[model samples]
Every structure is written in C-alpha cells, then in structure tokens.
Target chain A: MGKINIIKKLSFTIVILLSSFLFIHIVNSQAELTSPTYKIVDPTVDSGGGRSESTSYSMLSSQGGALDDARLLSASYRIGSGFPNGIQANVPIFRCAESSTDSGSTNCINFPNANGAQGECGIPGCYDRFKVEINPSGNPIDTLYLVAIYNEDTNTQYFLQSDHTLDTTYDINDYMTICELEGKDTRTGSGCETGGDPNWDLSLQSSNVLNANANTNYTVKARALHGDFTESDWGSEAALTTESPTLVFDIDIGTTSAADTDGPYNISFGNLTAGVVNTPANQIWLDLGTNMQNGMTTYVKDLYTGLYNGTDTIPSQSEDLSVDAGSDGGFGLQIGSVAEDALGPLLEGTTYDLATNNIGTVTTSDTEIFSTDTLSTNVGPITNGRGGIILKALAVITTPGGVYTDTLTFTMIGNP
Target chain B: MNKFLFYTIFIFCTVFTFSNVNAQETGAVPTLFNTEPLEIPSEDNLDLIAPIVANEQINIESSIKLSPAVINLERGSSYLLKIENNTNVTKEFTIVKSAFEITSDRKLKKIDDVLEEKLVNELEESIIIEDELLVIEPYQFKNVSIEYKQPILNYLNGVIVKQRDLLENSDENQSKLDFSGQLASVIIDPTLTREQLDQLKNTITIEPEKSFFGIALNSKFKIKTNISNNSAKLLKISGDITLYDGETRIDSKSLTQNYPSYFYPNDEVSIEFDFNKDERSVFNQIGERSAVKTLKINGEVVQISDEIYVLPYKILVLLILLLSTLMITSFLGYRYYKSPKKSK
Candidate 1:
C-alpha cells in the first residue's frame, strides 16, 4: 500500500509538471498565432462625406495599366482607391469605362455594361466609391464646408502635412471633385447640388447632402471607374483617418556579393522611394522600387515583408514575412520568387537604406562611393557609398523580366 | 520492482525526447499575413465584364392601372387578358395576377392566388401568364387582377389578396397585406405613341462580390433583381468566376446562362462561390488548417488576407488526442512500476 501511495504521488507530481509546461507552450503559441501585428489601409470615409484626418496606416492599390484590349476586352477592371489603415477593399465593388487611349479619361459612370457590350465604350476599368453621412445640428455653423475628391495613386502612404497637394489628375480616373467635404445644409424637400461630380450622371433626385448634424447623408463614392461603366460601389460611410500609434523598425533588403564590386543583388525593381510632395489630398503612396508585377493584384500583408537572398542568412525564421520570387537557392533567395518589375512604376522619391551580406565590416581606411548618384539599374551598382549602408540607389530595371518586386515596409516607432 | 519502475520511467523519457525531435524536424514553418483568399484574376476566355449602374428601390408606392375600366369576366376556364393604362406620365407599376374558377352552379370550387409583380415603366407594357391553375379542384379558372398605381416613382408597390370582387370603398384597401419582394428592372421599351400593347423587358445584371470562393468561408453571394417579366427577351448574358491563390488560378468549368436567372421580367443571374485552399488537405477538416499562412486572391487587384484562427472543434479534438496519448503513457508507467520481474 505504501509503495502504491508513493507511486501515485510521483505520478501526480509528474503530471502536474508536464501539464504546466504544456499549458505555457500552448498559451504562448496561441497568442503569437491569433494576434494581428499588421494593419490594412484603404481610402474610405466617415459618416459624412468629408475629408478624413491623416491616416498613419499603410495602403495598397489595384493593378493599374491598360485593359486586355481597347476593343471588346473583358479582363478584371482594377482601379486605384485611397485605403488608409486596416481596411481591405478586395471585393470588386464598381466598374469604370474610359477611352482605350493613354488619357484614360472620358469614361461612363460606375458599372456600365452588364452583358458585356461590343467594343462600345472603349477601355474598361473599375474604382472604389465610399458613401459618408454627416450631421451638423449641435456645433456652430448651419453649413459645413470641407474638400472632397478622389486622390490619385500612391505607392507609399506616410504622415506629414507638408506632403499633401491638390493635383487634380492623381486618381486612376478624375471622377470625384474638390467639393465641400460636408454637403450644403438644406430643408428636407429642397433640391441642392451636391458637389463631387466629375461625370455628372446624377439621375437620382437631390436634397441628400451630408450635414454636420443629422440633416442629410452624402456618398463619397470610390470608383474603380473602369470604362465598362460597370463600376462597383464600396459603401463606406465612416471616416478612415483616425490617430493611431505608429511603429518603426530598420527595414533592410540585403544581398550577397564580393566587396568593392557590384553584386548580383538588384534594386532595379524595388518599390521604396524618397518622400513625395504635390500629391493629392487624403491619399498616401509608397514606392519601394518597381519590382512588382504589372496588372498583378497586391495586398497590405504583401507590403509588409522584406526581400533577402537565401545566400545571406536572416537572424530568425519566425520573421513576419512573405515573398513571390522564382528562385530558392539560399535561405531566402530564389529566381522567380524575387519578382522583377519595370522601373517606371516605382518613382515616388524616398531615401533607401541599402546593404549587402557579402560586404563584411569595412576595416580599410580607403572608402569608396559609386561617384554618380544614379546606379546602373540594369547591371552593376550605379553608386555605392562608404560604410556600405547608405547606397542612394536610383530606380532601375535590373532583370529582363518586368517583374515588380515589393515587400511590407514597417517602422517600430520606439527605440528597440 | 524498484528496478522495473526505473526502467519504465527511462523508457517514457526516451519516447518523449524522440517524439519532440521528430516534431521539430517535420513541422512546417508558418508564414504571416498569407491568409485571405488569393485574388487570381480569371485567365479564362469567357470575357466577363462588370456591372455599370446600380441603385436600391426605396419608398415605392406602385399600383396597376387596368383599363376597359375594370370589367367583369366569365366564370369557368382560363382566359388571356391584357392590362392597359390610360395614364400620361412615365409611372412605374407592378401587376398581381390572381384568379379563381367557379363551378357551373355559380359557386366557387377551387382558388389559388399566384401573387406576382412586374415593374412596367413605359407608357404601356404587356405580360403573358401561361396555363395557371387558379381553382383547387372541379373548377376551371377565372381571370382576376389587383392593380394599384401612383404617379410618382418613389411610392412602393402594394399587393392585396381578395376572396371576391366587390367594388367596395377605399377603406377596404387597408385589409391588403404588404409584401417583401421589391421589383427592380430597366425599362427597355423604345417604342411609344400612346399604344396599348407595348412590351418592355427588364434588364438584369448578376455579379459575385469576389472572383474566387473561400474554403470553409461563406461564398460571395450573387446579387439579383426582384422584378418578374413574361414578354421580355433576355440578351447578352455571360459572366465568368475564376479562382486564384498567389501561385495559380482556377476558372469555373463553365458559365451557365439559361434565361430567367431568378428576378422578375426575370433575367438576372445569381451564384455563390468559394475555392479550395489545398487539395491534399481538402478532406481533413478536423485539426486541419490552411497551409497558406498568407492568402491572396488576385483578380485585377490582389486581396491579401490571413486565417490563423483555427476552428474551436479542431482545437478540442487535438487536445483530446494529446490527452489520450498522455493518459496511455501514464498507464504504462503505473503498470510497470507496480509489477516487477514476474511480468518480464
């Protein structure tokens, strides 16, 4: 009996210890798995159709370019929209019709041809439209005044008031206008002209203006505005700009090559660039360098990863990341995986922090620089500076394939 | 006995260590933010296009204005009748065709009210109702209709079920019950001239929210029209729904376009869809999670999404399996500790 008791006690103690270990492991894994560390940003609005506060969030755009063919083409019509932080407008909401020419102007209203018309309306694209509601009863003014318009395409979205501008032709299609963010306050039945109409297809009756207080509701429509004229409507009636804490971290894409010589690593299609000024209002863009695929749909999460060659080892595999290249020789390096893109799409202008794994600690007194500010986007390094970190590389096409490569760029605000 | 206990304990430790090593070796690395269905734009040749214009019907007060000034019809057998409106402006309206055939003795035999409506917007519109069984049994058919019309386009269409045709007062109209079906259609009649038999068709457009369907996720529901049409010709009906992950895109086997795609003057098409994340783990729903840590469905634009949330049942089942393994190991430990050389 005493032996049995002893065995039971031992077993109980062992079970308790094992259970505790398993419990801690499970909890840690579960927490790490469920918590979302990244936010998705899209251009949408608040209850009233007004400009949103500055969004500290990131953004992504639908693939923009030519349609399958100017005549009778039925490809996926993707247009650009302003998505601030944490909003995924992936659903195809509206369609747009535009002339097949380079102008991309003179298109019909959203979602036009249902049965697929015969080459009638020209090139087709789509835009995302956001509807907002406003009430101006309590505060001071009877009429609320604000600026509203569909801003142009942005690659890098940032937080700086000086970076804003009123460039009219930024969006895929110049659909919405710079009207009052708040609509005119009017009586229930009175007809009022609500501003933002680039196409002016207001067949629906008027009097629906978004007030500062419960007077009317206006729709700040985001249109992919594809030429099919069969555009979709992203029904977002709330403000997208909300003050949120921003994170900052050193995002570096490293390569492996001999020192003092141009390495195999290419910044040719990279999407990051210097800060952009004179862009549209309420719209942000980030251009890492044009390694992204043309007409290929992109996402917020895809914008979060860093591209590194497998030859250069990363600190940990648990790194929050994603990739789309075609090679896999090293830990992170692969051929098709590192999508090579054209240089034209990645020109926003931002300083890049470039580095390579092959260039070990610089011990020599002799420092080197590429001399020219512009690097050879096609072959060798156009320019490389001392300390090996600050390589002010220009946007170039390194690969023959026009693959646009991009990864998520983040900054963990605090000193880590 | 003490030696046996030590040996069993040693065996358990060895087994646990080996299992841990194996798990680490075979475990797949998890990539973040690769959830959400991939947006693989259809690579098919179906030539699918997006819808142009859309609107929701609100505050509609519609009625059917029948002319020949509400005449009485014969009792037995079904009859084809035409509804004519003498109104001037372009007014939107719905028609509710109901009938009851009386026996030869002038008594009602069977009755069925097939309540349906069509939004007719032109100056005049005509509809045909085929071999409708009005009465229950022993009765042929009687043609009857309840039509109401208001000049404005904002008033909603109203329906009323009546047992007998008694030209009563307007107060009796309150007895009519409102309906859920709202009629939506494009007025496609180009002909005018104050005609009495003009035929107009309903333009129906059906579209899915996303090009691809999600595995174990609610499919993109098809948006449809509610208007009914009997004389309109359905034209230009074709749409393609394609699926794609970051890697490959899969198109629907075929696009189905058989007329009267569910709404009235009926031409709208409807569909709900999702795509398979992995073919290997397709049947393994229990404790089975998507290998795609970051999933993107790219059509024109890439939709980045993630699915780290494992189903509760899957977690529970995994826990149970783990617990069973622990129990079995413990049982063996206990048995070996209690019995010595005799078992050996």
Candidate 2:
C-alpha cells in the first residue's frame, strides 16, 4: 500500500508540471507571428519590371493571432536600402499604422475593439491595409494586407493616407501643405489639388520617397506588428530598377490641324503682288513628345537673312513684322495654334503670335518658337505638343520679280 | 455684166497688192520686243534684254538644294555646283550671282549698287556659269559648270538659286509670296603664281614730267598727270598726290576724275589737280622753283621732278616793244643817210 501511494504522488506531480508547461506555451504564443513575405503588387511582373515613381506592395503571413487577442498588423518601408537580406543603416523608416475608427472603415484592419476599428495608438499612420483574420483558423490562414508608399492613382485602395480621398472634400491648405511637403506636385496654381471629385488623377503627385531616378536600383522589405505591439523580423528584400526618361521631337510640312510624319516639306508663297498679303497653302508643323520632368523647347532658324532671290529680297532680318501685309515688303513666320494632350498648354514664343499679328522673324540665328512647362502626357496617335508655322510675305511694287527662297531649320531640346 | 465683173476683179487685185506691200514693210522693221519665252543664252552672250518667263511651280517636296553650302573656287579651275530637286515634279530654277562683303562680325552683307558697274562686269567676265536657268526633272540633280576663267583677286560672293515663275498679272489689291531660295557662298581663292601677281602689279603706269608742263597764268597752279591701265583687268586707282618745291612740300590733292572711278583696261586718264591759294603761296615761298610730284602706283611711291619757268604776259609785251623800237630807229637812220648822200 505504501509503494502504490508513492507511485501515485509521483505521477500526479508529473501531470501537474506538464499541464503548467503547456499553459505557459499557449499564453506566450497567442499573438506571436513570423515576418511577412512581401512583393511589388500594383505593377504586375510583366509591367515595366514593376518599376515606377510610386510603388504598391502586398504583405502576407501564414499565421494569425488568437481569436481572443486584439491583434493588428503594420509595416515599415525604406528606399534604396535593405538589399538582398538585411536592412542598411541610416535609411529612414516610414512606419505604417493600424486602421482606426478615426479614419473611415474603408481601410483594412486586423481585430476591432468595441469601437469597430483599432487606433494607431500613437504609432505612425498605416501605409495601407493591414488585414488580419477575425477568427483564428488552425489551417494557417493568410493575414494579407496591401499598402502603397506613394500612389498617385486614387482609384487604387493602396493610396497614401495624407492625400485626400476621392470622396472627401479638403481645404486648399490641406492639399497644398501635403503636396508641398511631399515635393511631388510640380504643377503650378490651383492644379496642385485633386481631391473632391471622381477625377482623382487630375493633379496627381509624384513620389518623394522612391524618386524613380533613371537607371537606379531600389529595394523594399516588410515586417508585421502583432496586437501586443511586438514586431517581427524583416522579410527578404525585393529589388527593381527604373527605366530611362524619353523625349522625341519631329517636324513635318502640312497644316497645323492634321500633320503626318512624311517628309520633303517645303513652303511656297505664289507670286507676290504689290499691296496684297500672301500666305502659303501649307505651313510647318512641329510635333514633340517627352516624359521629361521639365518639358521641352523648340527653336527655328533660316539659312538666309530673308526671302532672297539673288538680286532682290523681301527681308525680315530678325525683326517682327507688324505692318499691313502689302504696305511694305517683309517676310516672317507666325504661330498659328498649338494642339496639346493632357499635359499641355505649349507656350508660344514671346514675339510669334498669330492673333496679335506678331510674326516672328526667321533669321540666321536660332529663335525660340514653342515650349512647355511640364512633362508631356502624349499617348498613341496623340501628340503631346503640336505647333504650327504660318509663313507670311509681303512685297511692294519694288520687290523684284523672281522666285524668292529660304531654307528653314528647327531645333528641339528637352529641359533638364 | 461682163464689164462690171472685170472691174471688180481689177479693184480686188489692186487692194490685195497694196496689202501685201504693207505687210512686207512691217516685216522689214527690226523686232525690239519678244512675246515668247527667251532662250537661255550662252555664257559669253551679254544680251540679256529679253525677260525670261519661268512658268513651272516650285515643288516643295523637292526643294532646290545646293550641295557644299560654301563653294571653294580656285582660279583657272573648273568646278561643278550640284543642284538637287528631290520632288516628284519638274522644277525651273534661276541662278543669280551677287556681290557680298563680310562684316566685322563675320556676317554676309550683300551690296547692290548700280554704280558698281565695273564690279558687275568683272564678276560676269571672271566666272562663267554654264547655265543661268535650269530645268530639273523630278528626283534628279543637275550640275552647274562654273569656270573661273579670269581670276583677279580673292573675293567672297554668293550664288542664289531661286524658283522661277512667269510674270502674270494678279489682283493688284492683293499681295503675292513666291517660293524659297538658297544662297551658296562662293569663296574665290585665286592661287596666282608669283610671276602672275607681279605682272598684275605692273599693269598700271604714270607718265612723269612732260605729262603736265603748261599751266594756267593765275594764282592757282593747275597740275595734271596721265595714268594708264595696261592690263586687261579693270582697276580702281585712288590715292593722294603731293607736290614738292625742291624739298619743301607745296600741296596735296586727291585724284577725283572719274564718276564711277573705274579705270578701264588699256585706257589712259588725265588726272588734274588745281592748287588752292595757300598751296600757291607755299610754292612761291620755295627759292629753287623746281617742283617734284609724288604719287603711289601699285602701293609704291614714285617721284617725278620738273623745272618751272613761267613767262609773264607783261614782261613779254615790254620785250616785244623794245625790239620794235630798235628796228624802227635803225630803218629810219639808214634811210636818212642814204637819201642825204644821194640828194643833199
């Protein structure tokens, strides 16, 4: 009987110790999670190698917190650091916050308190969605979340937080401060804000973090935060390289309204009579397109000083022609009109307006004709900039009868 | 009826004969004006009286383009200036030559002066452009043969290729603008041998002392010199002539003889200089009274000395009077002596 009792006591003590060990393990593992796996999510793999001024990422973890724990996920991002595996030093870390009731429920959140959403709890704002399963599933449910570092497109759910939402109405100060602080909106005047309506991309902002410099490499990694505020180790890095900027320009001889790429362009003003204004049937068309940040400019020049016919000439000589066509002999070019795409308003030269009859002189030196203030938004069949050249000539009775001629050259340059 | 028919036939014959005579007279007169298009003349022909009508429209697709925007033409060599028309239409082009000068800023400035007749004539004579008017087919190029036959010196000029159009009456109230033209710089770099340069330099000569001996009897002394251009090339002579009495400078005057101031080849010009009152006083102040004329010929200073002996009209009159009195007295005395010996 004494031996049996001793055996029972030993067994009881072993069972009790095993039960305590299991309880401690369960309590400690309630809200713990592994680092999230991340990749470029917005720009698909086939789309320019996921390289852009802005970047969107999706983070996923194989496990979630226990159902009873108020668990949430968060992420931090940096540019040009954390290559291959580990994060580099001195790189700025932009922390993402959990979705709270203060922000509309449109954002993703892990577990909600009685207030229907979790607060950031003095942490940084969430980069984007931080979704977590409300009910824990033992089958390794994925805690998937989407976030954008600097997304200009408002339609996408991964847009940044400081920016105005599509449906929200924000004051001018809110828009200006955010855009200015971000250093992304290069447009001038009222175009800096695009918040109140459906056209979210009207005044889209550029990415300050991912500068998207040409021929540069960038890396991104992600980590997850549990409800207990315990953070996981950073996942492996994803790298991308940006493409070079593009600029293209061409000149064709035709009407301004409809111009083609075919060449052999020439301008002819039929026999100039005295006291009459002579204009050519066709004019030069300048076509330009570029993705350059600061836009482009075009210049024109002539081989001769004026319409020279060996012995006689109708001279312009670098002076604007503002007189009645036939009162005196003069030759010059006037800007007819400019057709531009979304990123447009191509500015005419200072002295080359057709409306004011300020015909620009074509001289032996280069003269600016058309220019733009920002990048070109041209697409297929739509030129970002189109400038027209209307050649005008006037000859008095003294203008010697002959075929006057000149050769014109156009030069285009992209702004830095 | 037979008589009336015969009269009518005779009258008709007379009328027809008179009309034929009139037509023949009209045909005999020289035709001064031409209504049709003038044919392009040869390089040697200077008769450009007829107006050339260029009727072909300028084909913009194939503009007239001259290769080697600057033409380097060496003397005594022939060069081909290629003019291209790359359009699908035939084109008529007129080539013209003009004088130009490079400014201080290295820019071309065209000079069109009717007074520069010698320059125009020299240009026409020195460079022979094979054809002044060209008719080029579509997508074809034509070569203009340029022969620098008579090179004088280095000069820069321009050859303009213009689209040609017929002179047609348009709405007088409206203005007309024609096609574009191209100007090719013609740089005439004459590579003359040393002997040739020396020969050219010696083409001008000045007659020395005897060319201006006699002078007007006045306080203003008139001086003259004969300058001759011995070469076939036209020359422009301009310089100051200084007159010196012994070693003392008397006067200086510019040679201002010709209107357009061009010395024709193989022609002699008498250039005269009239001294002012001050110059005459200076001449009188010199004691020796011998004068020296100094002028520049081909950048070299030349001096010609001449003696001055002036016979005043008053002195000549007194001398003639004295001689007449002597003759008269001698004749009277001889007559008196002979008469007395014979009769008294």
- Which candidate wins on DockQ? 2
Best by lDDT: 2
Q: State the displacement of the C-alpha of residue B306, model 2, in Å, after optimal TM-score superposition.
A: 95
RMSD of every candidate to native, in Å, equals: 38.9, 47.8
Off by over 4 Å in 1: A1-135, A139-416, B1-262, B271-314, B317-321, B334-344
lDDT per prediction?
0.23, 0.42
Q: Write the per-residue lDDT of candidate 1 for residues A1-416, one digit (tens) a residue.
A: 99898987887777667657655654432332222774322111221111112268322212111122132122433232222211222222112221111122212222122211111111111111122222221212222212232322232221101111122223222232212221332333222333353322221111111111111121222322223332333322222210101110111223321122111112332332222111111111111110001111111111112223323211111111122122221111111112112112211111111223111111111111111111233211100111112211111123122222322211100000
Over B107-216, each residue of candidate 1 has an lDDT whose tens digit, in order, gives 11112112122233311122223422222111111234422222213112222121111121213212111111111111111112222112322222323333223323
TM-score of every candidate = 0.16, 0.33
Q: Model 2: per-residue lDDT, tens digit, A286-341?
A: 65544333444556667566788768768874343456544557778888888764
What TM-score does the predicted chain A of each candidate obtain versus native chain A? Answer: 0.17, 0.51
lDDT of 2 by residue, B26-141 (tens): 22111112111112123322221122111122223223344333333456776666666655556676776655443332223344344235587767777777899999886687
